[model samples]
Target: MRHTDLFYLLALQKVEGVGEINAKKLLSHFGTAEAIFAEKSHKLKKIDRIGSLTVERLKDKSVFEKAEAELRFIEKAHIRAIAFTDKDYPEKLRHCPDSPIVLFSNGNIDLTNRRIISIVGTREITAYGRDFCKDLIATLAPLDPVIVSGFAYGVDITAHLAAIENNLQTVAILAHGLNQIYPKMHKKYMSQVMENGGFMTEFWSSSNPIREQFLQRNRIVAGISEATIVIESAEKGGSLVTASMANDYNRDVFAVPGRISDKYSQGCNNLIKTQKANMLTSAADLVYMLNWDLQQPIKPVQKQLFITLEPDEQKVYDFLNSHGKELLDIIALECSVPVFRLSGILLNMELKGVIRPLPGKLFEVI
Candidate 1:
């Protein structure tokens, strides 16, 4: 932000009764935030939502001075501040109905990364949620897509950390200002994220991360991404709100399934049964849903190699890796087992995401 526009922009944000929507209206009418600050009470009040009282408050010098101090804090924190008119402002977020006028971003991560996806779920994640994170990360790790989440516990933090661990850039859209990390316990992870990615908020510096702000924050998570993945959620919660917003924006909604009896899983199953989200069983499912290619040709598995396993037929995996590929006769000789029994075990492993089946009745580790 330019020096002259800095404090005035803060004043516009801090002005009493100048809500986000009306603030946008004033900006649209005046053509620049600079012009809006120069408006007289009567001119500012001309905007549809700008009430007479709001116009009266806009003339206060103290409001602008206090706002100037806020800007000083922003500068001290090494934060990036952008108005609606800034060229680098996220276009997806800017088009939202209640888009924020001034956004504060901390750290050096780019908000403009292409193909961003938001993954969110309950604060109380289950073992299933944990497993989902591991598998999903392993699958998409090679794609390098921008992963986004609210950075709350459970599914939110799982998704963000997975992306970071896999060397993928990720962003957390915070409900709080750039001044502090909410829930403070995750400060260590937040620090890692800034080193690898960064933080974002529609709210300004020093604003408390109240509950309502999260509802608004969730919209950006949905709006800014190519798709929103609901790892887990309840019937009524912010995750549902994000899924709804993703639908409204015509972005793909992908969800992971959980055990039906599990409360956390109930939301995911409901989303699937209702057709509100596409059910994904693996990372390949996600790639297919997104219509993207697998990163590269994973080496192929080839023949009836399972029959040659030594006794303890289930230990075919150890045999395959240690013994190299084998034919049916070679396998039957090694394991001294019927070819039929060995075939079944190999098929089961293929179904388990552990190995891939090959042509001419062969199998290999994936």
Candidate 2:
């Protein structure tokens, strides 16, 4: 976007009561932010929901001074202000009604035709959640999905690091300005993150990471991806808030189940029990549920000569080889393997290039 256009948008953002939804309505009517400011007060009020008080606020020119300062900071910092309507903006987030008018991004983020998923959970991650989170990213690495998460402690940082280890792009959505990094301890990861994927925020350079901003940031985390996964959470936390926002956006939400006795599992259990999210057991569940296999046609995986498989893996391979393509449940039933254990077995077989998963929860020998 041109500096002029961005200036007006930034100024519009400063106008009192002009939120994303209302700003969208005004922009839709006037066609441009500059036009909205140039229009008469009576004419502005004529537009639905643009009350007299809002028009009066728009007349305040102080917002222009703030916008100019922000613009200078953006240019100096080499930040990219991605307008909602820009082709380069995230397609999924652009469709959201409450998405920011302009997103400030500092990184090599290229969302074009990429499968994006957000993984969020409690800051106090447990051994179970940590292992599951890392394994899930490693398993899904074949598909090359971009991982999105808050750059916080525990699950957030873990997901980001796991993606980096797997050579995948990972985005860190910040609650505060890109001018500073929160937690201070995470400063060391900033350079690595910027090189690998980078940081994004709707907040300006003047903003700080306050309590309310975190709540607002959750919506972007939920809205920016095709799906949101809650690895673990207590009965109440930011991850659940993100999941709720994802549900409201009509996007896919998944939660990893834990034992009822576990405190961290309560949020995920409630989400599943309430039917707000699908139960995610493994990477296969997400792949199958999202039908990612269908997005790109699966290439035939040629089985290598003299490939050794575990006894259980051999059983699955033999069953799939004879049955052509079969559902996971059927293979488990025929091979006498529990579904839980069979998922890992099938994943191993896939990694060995002996078999591949098909759409609709089916697998076949390659």
TM-score to true structure, per model: 0.77, 0.90
Q: What's the true lDDT of residue 357 in model 1?
A: 44
Which portions of model 2 show Cα errors greater than 4 Å?
297-345, 348-366
| Alpha-carbon shift of residue 86 in model 1 (angstroms) | 1.9
Clashing pairs in 1: 303-362, 307-331, 308-331
Clashes of 2: 0
Question: Candidate 1 regions off by >4 Å?
Answer: 294-366
- Residue 245 accuracy (lDDT) in model 1: 89
RMSD of each: 8.2, 3.0
Q: Highest lDDT, which number?
A: 2
Tens-digit lDDT track of model 2 for 104-193: 999889899899999999999999999889989987888889999999999999999999999999999999999999978999999889
**Each candidate's lDDT (Cα)?**
0.74, 0.92
lDDT for 315 in candidate 2 is 84
1-366: candidate 1 lDDT, tens digit per residue: 787786777888788888777878887788766688677878777678787788777777787778878878887888888887788887777777677787888766775645578899999888877877756765666556778899898888888888878888888999988878877889889777887788888787667889898998988899878788988777667898899888888889988877777788778888899999988655555565675542233323354544343344456666666776665445556766554445444444554445554433344555
